[model samples]
Target: MRIISGKYAKRNLFTLKSNATRPTSDKVKESLFNSLGQFFSGGKVLDLYAGSGALGIEAVSRGYDQAFLVDVSGQACKIIKKNVDLTKEPERFKVIKTSDFRALKQFAEEGEIFDLVFLDPPYAKEKIIKVMNTLLENNLLAPHALVIAETDEHTDLPEVEGFELKKDHHLGRTKVKVYERT
Candidate 1:
């Protein structure tokens, strides 16, 4: 896969060897950034279940101050590091090789808040609700922060406890939704 816009536009990224990871599509990524608009300027980003780290890398390339990438698999972590190096943005990125969503709480406790959060767990897993709750309970999101979730079109997302659904778009078999703090 490759970065679709910003300074890193057209830059290629490495992918994990395993078939378990599903990277966001170029169309979805472009649409996501377009929807973000001015929100991309100099803000912190958190990419949960980072996989190849494409989404977070895009944010960094577009001028976000920093991106924190968290993933459970060792291979995924390695691929994300490679992708970071590919972008030559090691200083602007942080990779967490952890297996639980709870670790995100530690970031929150450290007073880390993100302007944008990307969640694209494996399809059929229904991980969005659980992670969204953690973000809210930990106050890991900045005021008016945007959280984008890409999932199979059929995944059922509940009304998040403190988040309001801002936008939802279906792209073929995939669905992309944007949520804002209530």
Candidate 2:
């Protein structure tokens, strides 16, 4: 996979030979950033279920102030770190080698709030609702924060609390939903 825009645009990211993660496609990533527009210029970002840190790294490249990438896999974490270093945006991002549950709690305790959050968990897992609740409960989302969720077209996400759906789109087998924290 590769970064499609920003300072690191067209940069190749290290990929792991595992079925544990799915990197967001360039088309989807471009659409996501396009939808975000200036909100990412200097906004704080969180990439939940981060795979190769492609989304978060792209945010940094696009000028986001900072981004936190959280993942449960050691291999993914290693690749994320490498990608950050390679992009030379290490100062703009951090890698959290922990499960979403633990990272959510720690981020909250540390008073880390984000303006944009990317939720792209594994498809067919049905974990988006639980993760959204945790994000709200931990106050990780800043007021009016924009939360983008990418899932398989078949995945049905529950109407989560503390946020209102602003937009929903379907691109072939991919579903993109944008939510604004109320």
Per-candidate total of colliding backbone pairs = 0, 0
Evaluate all candidate structures by whole-model CA lDDT and list the values in order.
0.85, 0.85
- Residues 131-162 of candidate 2: C-alpha lDDT, one tens digit per residue: 78888888888889988889898887767778
Across 1-182, the per-residue lDDT of candidate 1 in tens digits comes to 79988878898888877788988888888887888783366989899889999999999898899999999898899999999998776999999998556668678779899889998887434678888888888888899998998888778676776889999888887888899988
Candidate RMSDs in order: 1.6, 1.6
In candidate 1, position 3 carries an lDDT of: 91
Please, what's the RMSD in Å of model 2?
1.6
Candidates in order, TM-scores: namely 0.93, 0.93
What's the TM for model 2? 0.93
Worst-scoring 10-residue span by lDDT in model 1:
121-130
